[model samples]
Target: MLEEMVRPDVVVGGYRIEKKLGAGGFGKVFLAWRDGSPCALKFIHLESVGEWGWRELFIMLRHEFPNVVKLLSHFKWPEEKPEYLVLVMEYVPGVTLYQWARDKNPCARELVEKLLPLARALKAIHAKEVKHRDLKGDNVLVREADGAPVLVDFGAGTMPGAPRVTGALAPANLRYRSPEAVAFFLRENRKRGERYDYSVKDELYALGVILYVLVTDVYPFNGPDDELMAEIRAGKPKPPHVRNSRVPPALSNLCLRLLAKAQARVPDAEALCEALEELLEEAKADPHRWEMVLCYGWTADGRTTDDAPELVGHDSQAWLRRWIRQKPKRGRPPAPPVVAPAPREPPAPPVVAPASPEPPAPPTVAPAPAEPPTASTVPPLRTRVRRAAPVLMAVVGLAVVVGLGLAHVLGKFQPPPSTPNPGQSVLTSPVPAEFSPDGPTLWATHVHEVAPPWKPSEADAGAALSKADTPAPVTTVTLSSGTTHMKKKAPGSQAERAKKGNGSTGANVLLAVAAAANMACPGAQIRKEPAPQACPAGAVETMTRQLGLRLGERHGAGMPGEKQGSSEPVPVKAGPISVELAGDWDVGTDAMGRGGRTALPNGTHLTGQLCIGEKRVYGRITQAVTPTGDTFTVCMELIGQFDDERGLEIKSDGGAIKVHPRVEVKTVDRFE
Candidate 1:
């Protein structure tokens, strides 16, 4: 059904469908041609567009304003099924307000010029007791032909007598909700059934958000949903001038007043329009200051100079003028022609001449004639000295070598013995007093026969350790086998000497020797303490129960008689379904889906981003069309490989399912 609605060259009512324009949570919009004039055809499922929605359309038809998009006609589609409602309206060809600001880099005055008409448009609509509930940057368009702002997308609008459709709170973007509305929602959310009355103040707050984003390129209160809600309820956003100094003080103050929590503090639509007009007049008085680029490097203090080096030989002013006059070409421009150098001519062959020979003349000798003394006959003094210098140096070198050899032969040179530094003591091996060639050595004799194991008195040990060569302090532990083991004390130990009067000097020394032996001998093993015993079963069970309770509390589960949060999945019929992106996709653009069946029937829409790498479609299903042609809101992630036989799939708690593809996807970066 969505495919039939979006197919190009197909006649829908009187207008012919050209292509899809864009998609939102409720429906898909298409650019259609009627009598050679282009118009927008919005196709929304009948069930999703409530009775109040159609009434809002009637209100749009009744009230006409230059800044508001004009509604041409409305009708229900498919006489047999009658599942979708189509609204044909004048198409405003342009980029969104956000995109316009990004490209044109409008100044504070230019922004006021653009937003003034929107404020007046709001005033006109409000005169009839109608409120455009969903006002955002994306909802406002900057007309390409005349640079006029056109307010569009009044699907969430309501009149005084309109029945309630959106539950509890107004239908609006969370980022644009007023602080009072948020505070009311937080306070009343605990009640079983409560509703927050949407008012003019909330609409003005949304306008303030749009202004803040335009000036600073960021949301005033930004974070995760919960944190953002909390901030909207109680937090005070930073003023626009503080975030971006280029913003005018008057504009900044007005934006803050519009976003004030108290409803009385915010100006009505008509007052807001007057305020914008005053600001516009003030901006016109000082053209130079008001016309400076807002988002560029210019600041309130002064222009910010770039630290990067400028391109050599580039004249930016000339280039800008040339660009304005020249029409833009699509895709990458053709690379400059690369010309191969002309083949070099081979070098001309060397000229040759025929050999000419004549008989050699007899050798002739002539008497020398007296001539002036020349450089050839006698060299300069410097040249003569340079020529004789090498021979003289050779003789001197030979004499020096002979004298050194004679001195060495006479024992005049000898190397000095190595000696320790002044503060260092020389180490030497001490022979055991019991060791003798005629008797058994210490290692071969009985263990007790080695001069009673020669123990060092505490005084002697202290004196020996006082030297700089003392090893790190060690602790001796006596084991059950009557063997003592020594280990280095932990670092940062305050005691430098052993405990007084322990009288275990011999054991300590012996333990130190054993420890050194153990380190030096890799194969040696010192007994390690036994492994820790396993915990009792009762203790293990108790820990497990406590851990489960903590985890249950953290996850908001496992407690008896507690109701689950609204976000929990609800049961839905499971079956195979096919879907594809609702419109053309490209990198750095948002992508929406439109096809489904059975579990998610035809006309179901998805919202997501079209990323570059892997060419996969990523997003979630925001609204689902039922098999009976009804629609309901849903949150499920849509993920799958692009162009694969399995197609794209929606990952839900129900199960993974596929959506068959129908059309080839493409994108356009520029247009005529």
Candidate 2:
């Protein structure tokens, strides 16, 4: 049976346990107080006592890292009931990167900026002959006070020359292993005698994987152990841009290089940091090119602030209320007024009432003088006609003069109606001549039939498969919100489709013209009539149904490991991602740079879809230069359809003839 959780007032290692914050592999983490200050106490079960535990304690005690969790003190109980080991460490009052990413997956630039500090932390650990074998998102905490990232959890840590504390046969630790490390582990296991040595490269590789996940919101490789091993043997994985195209080529290339074969990858953590700093400089080089990319940071914490009064006993609710709250002041209520006896003379004065309620005297009445007939009552008819005659003549003459002047001005100023220019007509069309202004379209037919399968690392996957072990939280980040503003395309940008007479563009246009000229409705034809102004909603629905069916036939409905209708709105939080519009622009990215779809400071998700991998896919798209002046943030939702061949091609006569019909684009980001 699991050990009972310690209640408030329960003291361990001179610290009072406040509450169980969370449970980790070797023990439970609790919020505790020591010397009346908040601290974290991790209690390891006696059964978990082993060489690895002792070594982790040793590593933490001997060194300190600015970006790593600090160990304040540790103790073990031998004679105490329910024997246990307790470690007191600094309480990180910040949200885990795993939690932060759930709603606000950082883009490439943002992720790099945040991970740079972690890379330096790794360097520090490496310099001291230590390796944080488990460096996943959960192990990293961003300080709430500042956006600083701190690495935690040393359960799987090891020193360069220390004895192998973990068994070689353990498979769970292989998830983030470098290729060489994996090879060494396998070789040693096969021999049943040799040691599986880990090097700096192995840890660096894991850091690279973390970077990749942060940028793309997915693992670089996935599947069963054998499959992942095969990929490692291949010595190369798909680049980051393959999944997230917005990733700058330089950054993508750097991420790929970091994941290169053991010896080929960057030599050490210090070098990696230097490389990252250079990339950071490059990303922030151009001020005018930058745009705001909202990420997530601290929100709230379970622990109280330093100045908050501590609750002392078992009555948590009542004690907490009294501890932090002040007692209302009870001032001396006003003294009761002293009653004074009325004087005897005053009583006699009340009886001395005045007499003489005599009859009233006759009021003097004066006859009212006759009021003179006031000229204000009305003017005589003759006087009124005389006053109006001159005014009427003056008004008529003014009207006549003004009309003549206007006629003359119109005659002199009128110009002929300008004839429409051919070029103007070509440019005035709503649809572009090309489908994609950037370049050739990656047609659905030509693209891969299925997206590459992805899964958590073997270590993560194995831990997940086991019910006995409580897996560490591993949250995948995404764009937090569904609603996004639609920005107009920049001037001179190509139309949404191909240009007229430009091969595919022209062919599509011809098909549309023919369809307009030939058939007016489904299974019916009209000789000549103004184009239907509004198609019934029912008809549009039918068309959409048909289109979905055809697309389903052409391409599968969903990708592997993905579910239909699985997208849901994530809650927005304050602190970052709230922004203001520039003078010229009506909207801009969040100024604080700390929100995404999941952590919007303040806004409702009106409507939209958050899609992974498709950077350009958006129901609505807003491109704005942020205050950073180097990066352009694209706020988008994946919902509305683009004007493509699939959209233009609608069959009415059972594919007997081609038909190009006008398709009205759907309005996006709308709330009823």
lDDT digits (tens) for residues 1-672 of candidate 1:
364245778888888887777655345688899888999998766653445457557667677776989898888877676767888888999988976876676788989988988998889888888888778887899999999999987777777666567456654556677887777766634465676677888889999989987776656774323455667777477776765566788888888888777654456888998899999888988887678666542121121111111112344322211111111111121222344455656655645556855545454455354443331223222222233333323332343465522222223222133432221111121222332233211111011101111111100101110101101111111111111222233333211122211212112222222222222222112222212222211222221221111111100011011122322221111111122222111111224533211121111222211111122222222222211112222223333323322112332443422122232211111100
TM-score of 2: 0.44
lDDT of 2 by residue, 188-297 (tens): 23565555566788778877777766555455654333444555656666675554444676777888888999768989988888888888787778422223222222
Tell me the spans in candidate 1 whose CA falls farther than 4 Å from its real position: 50-52, 188-191, 297-672
RMSD of 1: 35.6
The true-versus-predicted C-alpha distance at residue 61 of model 2, in Å, is 1.1
**Residue 178 in model 1: lDDT:** 84
Clashes of each: 3, 24
Q: CA RMSD for every model?
A: 35.6, 29.3
Q: Candidate 2 — which residues are off by over 4 angstroms?
A: 1-5, 78-82, 160-166, 169-173, 287-672
